[model samples]
Target chain A: SQQGEEDPQALSIQEGENATMNCSYKTSINNLQWYRQNSGRGLVHLILIRSNEREKHSGRLRVTLDTSKKSSSLLITASRAADTASYFCATVWNNDMRFGAGTRLTVKP
Target chain B: GAGVSQSPSNKVTEKGKDVELRCDPISGHTALYWYRQRLGQGLEFLIYFQGNSAPDKSGLPSDRFSAERTGESVSTLTIQRTQQEDSAVYLCASSLTSGSFSYEQYFGPGTRLTVT
Candidate 1:
């Protein structure tokens, strides 16, 4: 069984707007990481938040994690057309990592 | 430095035939992983290798699937008697370490395998 499941399987927003995606997991995790995939290519690491931390920021990306709820959210502010891609949330428990179904985001220009 | 690389970007094999996929991790990275992504599905962990430690093969779907890494460099995944349901993209990633507390992983372009 998959450990992580993302809400809102697909999302669309205009450029310059903000897009938010949520991920829920079923087990305790040491950290949560977000990645982006363009078309059929491999994933690119976006941001990572540790269990001891609540929030993190990288450029226009903000990630928040709530261990009690076993959930996380990624917010991309001032989105751009280039931001159009599939976003996935991965949870790491010990040495194992599992990925969510992913949220496909399309930022129209 | 160069990123992780996988060979034969695309492969098409007949059912019951054997197939091998290769991955080359970034220089000096000790942690390597294999994952499979079926169409419209999330990535599934297949295996993990770190340094000289024994690999974690708990994620392998079946005995037909196996992987090996030599000296922390190149790794290969072999599948025997392939089935049509095995069609998917095989991805490889490498990190500085194996545990979840380590740095993020760097992914390769992936090899698309189709069992017809």
Candidate 2:
């Protein structure tokens, strides 16, 4: 069973536009991490938000966690062609991690 | 430093045959994990190893799926009899440690296994 569900299975945006992806999970988590995957490669860790955190920012990537809602969102501001990739949210609990299906984003140049 | 590495970027095997996938974690990292991703889907956790403690095998799909780690350095996943459904990319990751909240993981380029 998937621990998270990302909204907008796929999204298309212009290079300068902003992109937003949302994820919802079912159980309490120690922390949540976001990862990005290029076409044929492995996933790269983006940012991690602990359960106690409400929001965090790294570069142009902004992440928010609402443990009360059991949901989190990833926002890529000022998107670029280089940001074209798949994004995923994974939850960690008791040293175990599970990922959601992910959102495929395409930034048109 | 050299992150993590996996052998045979791509593999093609036949149904009912056996295949072995390997993972080499970063030096000094004490935690390792394995995951499988089907086409157009998120990765599914398969197994995890921390130090020399027993591995968490709850996520393994069946008895045919097994993995072994040498200390905290290298690990191999073996599927006794591959099935068509087993055609997917197998990914490996290693983290600095597995205790408390710091569980950031570094990944290796996955092994694309195609079972025909």
Among the numbered candidates, top DockQ falls to 2
State which docking tier applies to candidate 2: medium
lDDT of 1 by residue, B8-65 (tens): 8999999999999999999999989999998877788899998899999988999999
* Candidate 1: segments with Cα more than 4 A from true spot: B98-100
- Model 1 error, position A76 (Å): 0.7
Steric clash count of candidate 1:
0
DockQ, in order, for the candidates? 0.69, 0.70
Q: What TM value does model 2 have? A: 0.96
Measured against the true structure, the TM-scores of the candidates, in listed sequence, are: 0.95, 0.96
Q: Please give the distance, in angstroms, between residue A31's alpha carbon in candidate 1 and its true position after superposition.
A: 1.1
Which stretches of candidate 2 lie above 4 Å from their native place? Answer: none
